[model samples]
Target: MDCETGFCKNDVQCGGAGGRPPASLAEFTLGGYGDQDYYDVSLVDGYNRQVTIEPIEGTFRSTGGKYDCKKAGECHSNLLLSCPEPLRHLNSQGHTVGCNSACTKFNTDQYCCRGDYKTPETCKSSTWPVNYPKYFKDNCPTSYSYAYDDEKSTFFCRGSNGRISPDYRVTFC
Candidate 1:
């Protein structure tokens, strides 16, 4: 994406437009508040394919990196290998493959972050079926693996184009 008035400084030092950092489609500058952007990548639903997001440039602290449904760069997301046995999805070939969340896999209010577990504390990653949340989190630190995921799953980039609001990108690798 192109910004007409500002710059997006990617925290990781990827090459941004005209020497500024950017998100999936915009650029920014760092000195102003109105020019800031925030973003997140989520897998709270499940994993089916691959995806990669790398910051290309900027002066902000965003320093983007790569993550896929299967792996972060060459490091495996480990969904298929470490996902809870009950939450595993298989292909027609009957091989263990993708994985779903406890909420989707079991439809439980506790795991789905509904009912009594509406708060972040009630629906924590450890309260579910095994360490399933960690299964995804350990694989993709930049993405959400469960209902209560915060801070660690969010990212920010400086926006200098004098624009507000944010953008998101979901690509399959």
Candidate 2:
């Protein structure tokens, strides 16, 4: 018996006594998503054949502020979605990851309201997840201040003396 994409061949006697269909070709057919570039598949048969497909690149146009972690360490956009669990840990391991201070308005009525200052420090300490290091706790323990310096193209935690600390020089992106 032999099988191809759309058909199969089986050898059987035509007369005397009817021969059974080849067991190999009994349950085989063109079964998969016809339009998808790749199929979600499982082979129940004993044969160990290998297959590979080239990736298809799509050109969907998007309209929004681009996520430029390279320059800002973090970006604020509604377009961002929750990171997957495993990657969330990795992204937030050293410092607060995917933190968006610009979009979240901190006011007296807000749930995160603790004081007058509307800073990432307040938001991060109170609202950000506890597993990862907060901005002040990990990167700027002594300074407790951070800024996205466009000139330097980096997010820097500043010390109390208004100087970028050696500890805060590490890249969060």
lDDT of each: 0.52, 0.22
Predicted candidate 1 versus true structure: per-residue lDDT over 68-97, tens digit per residue: 112122225555676567766765777665
Candidate 2 per-residue lDDT, tens place, 1-173, comes to 53321112254333533222111111111212421111111111111121111111121111222311111222232111332232221122353132222112121322233454345445443443432223212332221111211122212121223322212112211
RMSD of each: 12.5, 25.5
Q: Model 1, stretches more than 4 Å misplaced?
A: 1-35, 58-75, 161-171
Candidate 2 Cα misplacement greater than 4 A, ranges: 1-79, 83-103, 109-173
User: Counting only residues 3 or more apart in sequence or on different chains, how many pairs clash (N, Cα, C under 3 Å) in candidate 2?
Assistant: 0
lDDT measured at residue 105 in model 1 versus the true structure, 0 to 100: 74
Candidate 2's TM-score reads 0.15
Least well predicted 10-residue stretch by lDDT in candidate 1:
19-28
Query: Of the candidates shown, which would achieve the greatest TM-score relative to the real structure?
Result: 1
Q: How does each model score on TM-score?
A: 0.61, 0.15
